[model samples]
Target: MNVGIETGPVRTGGYASSPERSGLAKFVSDTSAVFVREILLLLRDPMTLIFSLLQPLVFLALFGPLLTGALGQGSTAETLQWFVPGVIVMISLFGTSMTGSNLLYELMTGSYERILATPLSRSSLLVGRALKEFAPLVVQGLLIVVLCVPFGFILHPLHLLAGLVVLGIFGIGVGALSCALALAAQNREWLFWTVQQTVLFPLLILSGMMLPLDTGPGWMRTVALFNPLTYIVDLERALLGGSFTDPDVLQGVAAAVATCAVGLVVGIRRTRRTA
Candidate 1:
């Protein structure tokens, strides 16, 4: 959670020389530096690093087999096809959904303001953090897919790649929104936590990350149709399972684009204001 911590040292004495760079070059350099810094911080804590990835493995270990058995006369292949997609989506969502708390910590410590005082662009700052969060989320997601390989899950190469991109879009959206929430409720920990808890579970349910909507009650199915995440999950499952037909994948792409687009707008505006 070292959102603004430096991973290296710098010398700025009377004898230290400053190097000149072009605008685009400087922008890329700064963004990449922040991105790497966030990554180093993420891996610095052994416990947090492990926990960020362990949930999907836990679910894969604890539920993969059980889900295979519980799919109601469904074959092993069918179970994996159905289960792996949801698990992948869950990995991406849960891995970085709570990153807002890290932002809050930085705010309280004044690290956020310190970073803002620097020359780094606010968009770069937001993108760096989002990309950092996306790194583990994507890794965890692929790990989930790999773990499911033994559980009768089959991978379609192109579809898997497409699914990963969709998962990335979803993670970026969630991470951006998380940052917005943290910035909005900078001093209101209770409200922040409450809002996070309140929105997260319902969204999880609506996304059908743990259970298929088809098997759920009629009301839940109806409600899930409205959730953009529902389309995301549906597309991932379809692609992973090699059932890519009709409008599911297209709908998912559209939804993911829309969600992330909104996230970028809101995140950029809020981040500038917060800074």
Candidate 2:
């Protein structure tokens, strides 16, 4: 009776009382740590920086001139205008694909399990890894833009911003898909090599990396419609001073959204099992 009388009202925190809150907080902190680690790792690998800068520059110098005659006068100038955006997208794809390699490496070394053993949420790990991949691409894109200024390419600020956003979104979607595929792959190294030829090359061709869709065959044009990279290229073209119809732009946005959604679902499921 005395013990029962000693008992009083017990109160708890409101929304903050939810178990998810602590998990979310831990996830945020862990995600930040992951991002920082990724950046530092990239910094240590000087080759990544060299290649990232050189690839676009080489493409601009080589293909930029070759395609000049085919695109015609004003169009040639306009096509040349696409160099920066194209390079930006290219870097985004390449850089983001590396995320898969990182994930695969983690899986191979059991680092993924270590991370999952912590309180971090799955979303945080996935997103933080994706963003870490994207950050370098952004820096490379800006560097390419800076280089373009000396070449007489006047990039509108809004256009530049829009192009970066598109590239970032596209990169995240593609990177996630690549990561998921890699995770599911029995032989990750072999799969990584094949992805370049299979996934990346098609995206480049369908996206008009070398030539405009108008210059391609009717069937190729139809195929391009289905390629998500086409939208990225179209969005880049629009950002770089070419005409882009509302419907076409909308299609591109849809493709990017769809790719990202599917990839995310697959990646999350795969990671959960592996993690």
Candidate number with greatest TM-score: 1
Task: Please write out the lDDT profile of model 2 over residues 178-243, one tens digit for every residue.
Answer: 777777773557867686567777777787767677867899999987877877767776766634
Give the residue spans of candidate 1 off by over 4 A: 1-27, 243-246
Model 1 lDDT per residue over 159-233, tens place: 888788877887777888888989999988887789988987798888887776778889998999889889988
Instruction: Indicate the residue-level lDDT of 81 in model 1.
Output: 82
Location of the lowest summed lDDT over 10 successive residues in candidate 1: 9-18
Clashing pairs in 2: none
C-alpha RMSD values across all candidates? 6.3, 6.2
Model 1 Cα shift for residue 68 (angstroms): 3.8
Error of 2 at 161 (Å): 1.2
